[model samples]
Target: MSMQLNRQLPMPADLKAQHPLSPAVLERKAQRDREIREVFEGKSDKFIVIIGPCSADNQEALLEYVHRLAEINEAVKDRLLLIPRVYTNKPRTTGQGYKGMLHQPSPDKAPDLLEGIIAIRRMHIRVIEGTGLTAADEMLYPENRSYLDDVLSYEAVGARSVENQQHRLTASGMDIPVGMKNPTSGDLSVMLNSIQAAQSSHNFLYRGWDATTGGNPLAHAILRGGVDKYGTCVPNYHYEDLMRLLELYGERDLLNPAVIVDVNHSNSDKKYKEQIRITSEVLHSRSHSRELHKLVKGVMIESYLEEGCQPIEGERTYGKSITDPCLGWADTRSLIFSIAERA
Candidate 1:
């Protein structure tokens, strides 16, 4: 006997429509975009801090965290451009893990992608409107870009996807500056190629439509450290390493001249405390290389109201990361002050 297969079909009521960007949010995002551009161009020396939970799983926790961050942002407004990481989607190496708020908001629950998209947009809009601070996020899926294009001030292409043609094409047309992270294996060439791709005009199918992009001149690189067979985190933003990258890219006229250093991830081997120390060292080391100092525009940090992380598939813990561990609020505040003093 043959068995019949059954598949559930989505109902019209179950589909969520894409939300519209409010005029107020658009105006604010425009101002934030200008500020970010100024910093990238050397017109402003403000240190850009992209801080938030590794996975924004809990809306309440994230909102409370951003409220606190807003207060700190005001304190360092003159020297830092604080952009909260309202990241909604996450990429996994082996295709397993929490994913993020947009994928599996409730552990073990089936995905409601339509609702997930709307939820993230609503969250992003609320964060910006409430905190009065700009925001940043990694663009993981090209299809999701439309949901966020109007609200984000800054964007990043993660290490794993930076080498993909689709992501590069997406960056080329981005209104906001985009940072391409170094490859997972710690290869700088991948980032270089990514920057090159993002800087060139491209013709590709985008969002189910034929599209043409003018290319983005503000596309830049990020150093997020690399892993070796010895199980050691190798810092790639050292003065010598940065100088070499700059020099090489300069020779090819492909250098962005503006780079952001990620203090977490492999840079600190996922040790949240080390992120602060490494950030300090990078800032201190900058004084020795004039060219590199001028090129090192900002830093990226993973921080939240609490330190460390909890399993996503288990009982949820408030204020803790559902993905990678992040610096706690106290340490994050201290690091911001230290960065300001040094700057």
Candidate 2:
């Protein structure tokens, strides 16, 4: 066996006990959860903007970003809900590079899984305590969901993991909103199938027990675009693309048939600055048709305090992304108000 056994890590329950959330923080998280779920359930019409750094690598910087977002959230509480993307885990296309805060709590440090888990939880709690908003995180490792279950209000299954059965099953058990992204190959059917699985009851072996999930009706679609066979980026946030998704949803019996367009990734070909234009276009599409207005519930944006990204090795800049390039805070703030105006 080539795999070396690491020290046994503490269970999520034990860790939660060791460093728990305050009562006020718990109440705020619960309220945020309900509001987000209401949007998926069609009970609320407010738009969702899942925005934040691509990978939350620095705790201090991340909290500062969230605090700024909180001020904006207060100003736009009537029209929009801004949920930060405190993505502690990241998916690597080549299985190399920084895997996220879950692998290395500090970008410049080595892998320390135990400390990473604790650090992620603490960072998430701080976001809530300081900003009163629970964030979204990628469900990269389905087994690690419990570590963040209580603190995260939203979960996303990345394009790479969307078709995995374990991800589907784990999503089924989640009580909050879960966004399933189209596969890297841009297969809509694969994403729809994963959504179907997540919206159905399942009994599976999770951790050490036979876990049963009653199905997650809030499971929805997230269009982050995809790569073509020729390695070209294919965007799907256009009016025609959204219409196609609406037609696809019409053919299915899935619940809460909503879509959230990811403004970055292949949609803008990772051009961080393009997020502003992409978001405007998506909102325009939503305005042109009533069907789209209801079907397209929100958007996912990669934004941070500083615009763009930096190399992991040398002289890291504060508040900038260490992973995917992202929109800067100034553009991000303007974009949020723009979305609120049009959404």
Please tell me which predicted candidate would have the highest lDDT against the true structure: 2
Task: Judge candidate 2 against the unseen true structure and give its global Cα lDDT, from 0 to 1.
Answer: 0.93
Off-target runs (Cα >4 Å) in candidate 2 are: none
- lDDT: worst 10-residue window of model 2: 125-134
TM-score (C-alpha, index-matched) for candidate 2? 0.99
Residue 19 in candidate 2, Cα distance off native in Å: 1.4
Residues 304-327, candidate 1: write the lDDT tens digits: 888998776657668988789998
In model 1, which residue pairs have backbone atoms overlapping below 3 Å?
none
lDDT of 2 by residue, 21-119 (tens): 899998998899999989888899999999999998899999999999999999999999899999998888889999999999987888999999999
RMSD of each: 3.5, 0.8
Error of 2 at 281 (Å): 0.8
Residue 294, model 2: lDDT of 91
- Per-prediction backbone clash count: 0, 0
